[model samples]
Target: MSANSSGVVKVGVIQQANTADTDANLAKSIAQIRVAAARGAALVVLQELHRGLYFCQQEDVDQFDLAEPIPGPSTQVLGQLAKELNIVIVASLFEKRATGLHHNTAVVLERDGSIAGKYRKMHIPDDPGFYEKFYFTPGDLGFQPIETSVGKLGILVCWDQWFPEAARLMAMAGAELLIYPTAIGWNPQDEQAEKDRQRDAWTTVQRAHAIANGVPVVSVNRVGHEADPAGGAGLDFWGSSFVAGPQGEFLYRASIDQEETQVVDIDLGRSEDVRRIWPYLRDRRIDHYGDLLKIYRD
Candidate 1:
């Protein structure tokens, strides 16, 4: 399709498999970003913690070494690539803020190779296999969108994708699109039916976010299986990375078990048209939402 009358932005999502080698992983990411740019993507987003495997699968203190400062090696490489490719890049990192302080930060690099802004993953999950709370400090930065050359991006991480409040807040704060860099998967022990339900629920919630907020949603998840460090069943990361339009329509979807770098064209002007018809934002009863701030009513 040619450029839309309302203007179009080509966004790319990179779904990749990570290994133990950090250098190799970064090289793979750089190569994928170049592929996306070659396909005419103006903005590209990599999977969560693309530098290595999902090390948060276990709460090993040794994982702390994975955290690096904002201006560290990863950002430097991504920034230079963004400049060279003239594309806005959203990258998730294990951020080493200070001594004993680290976060799951999503960094945005502008087309000029400078750090535009960042969003720390607000929702840290600590489950049976995915133990992230042990590694990341809960983000202090509120629900804010990072302004980029392409548009305002409401960047979030894996666990944060489940919360609708976060998406609404970003939409209210003028986010053009909601983006998630995620690393979620299923246990081998679970039944195939259960796994299908989990994957469906994951996609449904994010698409609902797009429908409710009148903004598009982009979710990029990792592919391949990472062995459990604690010697149990490994996780088969369901790699159905996808993009949804403002009306919650599927624009693009990647394979469940392959490394994909896909570029999808999003019409930014469609939000205006959809919002005018739905008007969910206009009909909100702000006075009754005080209960949302409470933990429980009963």
Candidate 2:
């Protein structure tokens, strides 16, 4: 372990294959977290909505039962675990903020068993296999970094990973690392070539975030086949959870078809060195970038 000022910390990502049973899924995640902590990970991230299967594949109002309040059961369990292991934890959950409002939220648990902060996923997708907008309200938290014992984490959920603005704001806010808890997969009906392209694009975009922001990026994705209960075609979740350095080099990548608990040591200070050489932040003309907030220019 590198000293506090050095910004070096061991991080872990848990890539899991889920079944229909939520209880079983949560148990599996807890077990994997233990394994990661044992391997000396100071920070651990779980796959998006790891407590249950990807319910957004299709929207049924009945699936609302899956959403729980922030300080409810799931965070309680995670907070206890973080305190026990003395590690910072990033966990994604379907949040029931109120009676009719809900969000896809990632909660960061501090080492002292308190809720450090949370990020609601701002980018909601409404594609065929991903019907997130039908279920989630766009995040109101803005692109802010969550302070924790390990460091300030620029945490975002799956769909938010595609936006460069999200990553840039977090970095500007002084996030030490950018972390994403993702649940993305391939449509089984797509051609093999198409599947490969989709996976490659997903990985490439997030790596670009790391390189552009001059910060290490950690993304944990789910794995295995989840046959659509509504029945058209299933999704084969490509489980390639990965961690990349500030320069966008892969530190570790898990297998595409298996469940894994991967731990990698990262020198967070490297971001400073990378940014100093690239000077992306230094050269930014913040005053001239007002167009970024606009929807678009026709």
Candidate 3:
């Protein structure tokens, strides 16, 4: 653990499997955050939608009942913890913006009891077991950095992690680190090779974001088997919550099948050193990127 002039700031990740009970899930997350703070973590991140089961398995109108307001009970609890520990926290939640509007939101809680910033999930997936399009309205918050005591966090949700544009935009906005609160896993029916490929691809893409932006990347994903409400063999959430350095080196990695809380110290200033050596930002062709904003040309 390398400390700066101010002292070392340890970042924590909580990777846990979810059950059917929302209150129990929230309590478990709070306990984990307390454990992480006790271990000296200054910034802690929870897995995506940590309060309950991955209800996106099927799109029932009743599932909307799970969504709550931004400053609802969950945020209140996390905000209180953040203040009590004097630490920064990135927490994911299902936000009910209005009667008919909802969003997959990630809230950044500052060391104080106030809300720091929030980012609604931009990319909504509607795959076999992950049917998010029916529940969430695409995020209106653009790629922006949330300023906190620790550093500027470029917080994006799970599906948003795959887009380089999102990462680049955050870097352009002077974000120091790219943080993802994710809920991705493997289908039980997948072959061993396929499972390996899925996990590898997930990690590789996030690492690429770190390398390309010359910043650290922190990804916290859920673990264990979450049953698909539709039945059959459920989805197995490959834990593997990890943190990568500016040059894409692994700082810490959790197991793929257990609940773990790890507090890893990261040198926030290292990104400047890495970027000075590899000046990707200095050489970007911003003027020509107009074509990038367009859908593909035939």
Best by TM-score: 1
Candidate with maximal lDDT: 1
lDDT of 2 by residue, 71-154 (tens): 999999999999999999999999999988999999999999899999999999999889999899999999999988888889
Question: What does candidate 3's lDDT look like per residue over 63-158, in tens digits?
Answer: 888999989888898899889999899999999999999999999999997899999999899998888999999999999889888878899999
The 10 consecutive residues of candidate 1 with the worst lDDT sum are 1-10
lDDT of 2: 0.91
TM-score of each: 0.98, 0.97, 0.97
Q: What is each predicted model's overall lDDT from 0 to 1?
A: 0.92, 0.91, 0.90
Better of 1 and 2 by lDDT: 1
TM-score (C-alpha) between model 1 and the true structure: 0.98
Candidate 1 lDDT (Cα, whole model)?
A: 0.92
Residue 15 C-alpha lDDT in model 1: 97
What TM-score does candidate 2 get on C-alpha atoms? 0.97
Higher-lDDT candidate of 1 and 3: 1
Residue pairs clashing, model 1: none
